[model samples]
Target chain A: GIQVEQSPPDLILQEGANSTLRCNFSDSVNNLQWFHQNPWGQLINLFYIPSGTKQNGRLSATTVATERYSLLYISSSQTTDSGVYFCAVIPFQGGSEKLVFGKGMKLTVNP
Target chain B: DAGVTQSPTHLIKTRGQHVTLRCSPISGHKSVSWYQQVLGQGPQFIFQYYEKEERGRGNFPDRFSARQFPNYSSELNVNALLLGDSALYLCASSLSVGTDTQYFGPGTRLTVL
Candidate 1:
């Protein structure tokens, strides 16, 4: 089983501030994604970056497969951005495609 | 296009009872997976079905089961549910079985007493 660890278990910031969240996995991954669990308990896909860099609006993500780590950046954060950010991945091993999710980083953006 | 949809947004049951949750995946998506999200914890994989076949399963007990229909819709059934079975059940659909992006539904909150 692959272990996923997220840094900064909890974060609080003022609106418009920027923050970085990191995810470290214990194994190589062929599928990696970032998700946002909103207040309503809906899991929203943020980024599906297995490698390289991708940006969506004020949010961006970068994954280094070799290092087995990924970073999610939120710029100009808004009150709506307050949610649990999670990193999920499937190991590159054969016949193993189950997505293992990290415990998540809880972020609170105050208006 | 409509995203993944789940039925009975909320449900309440008692221990030793059985409950079934339904999910309709996005159009053209043939893979449906189920996950359980306990309070204060991340979602845990339960089962993955592709082309109406069981592709993968997690560490859940035998009491948990799921099946995919011809239309790619899915149902998760739990038998002899225990108090620990109380959690949010989420269904996700992907274009293909493995290594594809999965779009999740709003999830059904199950309360087992």
Candidate 2:
């Protein structure tokens, strides 16, 4: 079983500010993904990055497989970005794809 | 194209009763997985089915079971429910069984009385 830990369990940022979130996993993972769970309980997939770095508009993510950690960057945050961000990982065991989710980083962007 | 669709947005059941939740995966998706999300916690994996066969299961008790159909649709069955079993049941579908991104449905909110 793999353990995923998310840092800054809670965060508050100004609308135009920037923030970074981190996720550390205990073991090697076959896959890693970032999800945004809005206040309405909708889980939206943000990125599916197992290695390397990816950017989607104002948000970006980088995963260093060797270090077993990932970082999510949000630049010029907006109020709509206020929600819980979660990072999920699948361990490299028998091709198991069951995601081990971290507690999540709760972000609040205020106007 | 439709994403994963779940039946009955919400459900209420009594203790010792049986409840069944249904899920229809996205078109062309061959993998279906079930999870339970409790308040203030992340979704916990329950079962994973691929090509109509059980591929993996979580730490949940045997009272919780599921199966996939030939068309890749799935159903989750929980017997002898308890108050602790009340949570949001989420069904997710991926392109394949392993190491793929899962698209989740709106989920079925179940409350056991």
Candidate 3:
């Protein structure tokens, strides 16, 4: 079983601010992704970066697999971005292919 | 295209009862997985099905079960539900099994009394 840990469990920022969320895994992962759980409880995929960096709009993510850590960056935050940001990962071995999710970073962007 | 769709967005049941939650994956998807997310917690995996076969299961109890249909749709059935069973049950679908990126439905909010 793999263990996932997310930092800044709770975060609050003013609109237009930037923040960085980090996720550290206990083992190597073949796949890693960042998800946004909106207010409606729908989990939206943010980034699917197993390694290197990816940017989508104002959101970006980078995964350093060798270091067993990943980061999600939210730039120019908006009210709509307020929600729980989660990091999920699957190990290289196909033990279950089930995602091991971190507790999540609750982000609140004040308008 | 339609994303993952779940039936009965909300539900309420009593303890010791049986309940079933349904999920229809996106078209052309062959893998469906079930997860339970409690209040203030992240989603926990329950089961994973691919090509109408059980591919993997989580650390949940035997009372929890699920199956995938030929069309890749899936159902999660819980027998002898407990108060602890009250949680938002989420169904996710991916192009294939063992993929980390998943598209999740809105989820069914189950409240047990």
Strongest candidate by DockQ = 1
How would you encode candidate 1's per-residue C-alpha lDDT over A1-111 as one tens digit per residue? 899999999999999999999999999898999999999999999999999999999999999999999999999999999999999998998887678999999999999
For model 1, the superposed segments whose C-alpha errors exceed 4 Å read none
lDDT of 1: 0.95
Where does candidate 2 chain B have its weakest 10-residue lDDT segment?
B97-106
1 or 2, which is superior by TM-score? 1
Q: Under CAPRI classification, how is model 1 graded?
A: high
Model 2 chain A worst lDDT run, 10 consecutive residues: A92-101
What tens-digit string does per-residue lDDT give for candidate 2 at B1-113? 98899998899999999999999999999999999989888889999999998988999999999999999999999999999999999999999966788898989999999
DockQ of 3: 0.80
TM-score of each: 0.99, 0.97, 0.98
What is the docking quality class of candidate 3? high
What lDDT does the true structure give each of the candidates? 0.95, 0.92, 0.93
Question: Which candidate leads the pack in TM-score?
Answer: 1
lDDT of 1 at A76: 96
**Candidate 1 C-alpha lDDT tens digits along B1-113:** 99999998999999999999999999999999999999999999999999999999999999999999999999999999999999999999999966899999999999999
Cα RMSD for candidate 2?
Answer: 1.0
